[model samples]
Target: MSRVSRDGGQVLPFYAAMMACLLFAALAFVAVGMAGATRSDAQGAADAAALAAAREVRDNAFKGTDLLILTPEEWEEIIRGRRFHTAGACAQANAFAGTNDATAECAFDVPEFTVSVTTNGTVGDSVIPGTENMHARARATALIEPRCFLQPATTPPPPGGGGVVGIECRDGTVIIVNPSDPGPLYKLARKLFVVRLTD
Candidate 1:
């Protein structure tokens, strides 16, 4: 056989294989990045849904304030408030999910005022095969906690019995005054609550 240089041709297959691997590596990196983005999007949706669902309690709480006085039993309920409706709260969650281009599967833990929402939104057009079917999902739970805390009157006065004096020491600021304050009774009965995501 003639001593023909085969160096260039010999490296061609090796270089081609390396190029293919590099291409695949790049593709894999892109796919992972896309999947991460999808997951983040899903998480955002789930968080929003949970919060919106929990806020369903807020409107009802505000409505509950319409009553001039929250009786002992009613006040007890506010302390252990159970105001959210499953269907209405889920509706809020679904609407929030739709805004984020996701669908929500929501569950309300009544009495606890916790809303758990799972968001399902696919990350589209993944470069890797089979990854297109990846459905990004995330679960988030939110809680509604009341802000008002009052110690019941210890001693009942004679005749008309008694009424709330005031809720003392809000952050060390004694919220003094009798029940005469327009806002105090309103604040007590229809207290605005705070919503926070636990997971």
Candidate 2:
């Protein structure tokens, strides 16, 4: 009877220890899942924010921002072939991140138009005792790529059948005047850039 009582006491303690371990494991798993969810949310916010900023740059620059007036060489020196508004692009990033419950840590200052951001809120429900304050962050990139390639006609069009460089042939072929022609190419080149997300 004494043995049984002693063994019973031991069993209860051991069982309680096992239960405690299992509970801790479950909590840890939940915390990890919450962290992952927060990370993905941050990444989504970053992606949206970057795209917004890139689009802002694209739309504004293509439509003849003050920067466009500068010579291509000067523009390249300033923005590395991609022109964007620093303040306006950051504003767009902020707006996008705000909608996603995140905050932009930096503006679109990279030469290639990249941005980084962090979640505004923590993974509040992280059950782990030490990780409740952890924040998630992410980065994203966007591009304003040229959609059109201007190629000068190799051969003259049929007599009286052709016009200027803007005209396109029936076979999807188009004539591109000399870049230095000092005519339509300069005015129309800006239209070629199409906004896209590179990464």
TM-score of each: 0.75, 0.68
Please give the clash total of every predicted structure, in order.
Answer: 0, 0
What do the candidate models score in CA lDDT, each in turn? Answer: 0.62, 0.64
**Per-residue lDDT of 22-88 in model 2, one digit per residue for the tens?**
9989988988888899999999998898888877666554344332234434333322335444557
Instruction: Provide the clash count, candidate 1.
Output: 0
Q: Which window of ten consecutive residues has the lowest lDDT sum in model 1?
A: 154-163
Worst 10 residues of 2 by lDDT: 156-165
RMSD in angstroms between candidate 2 and the native structure over all alpha carbons:
7.2
Clash count (model 2, backbone only): 0
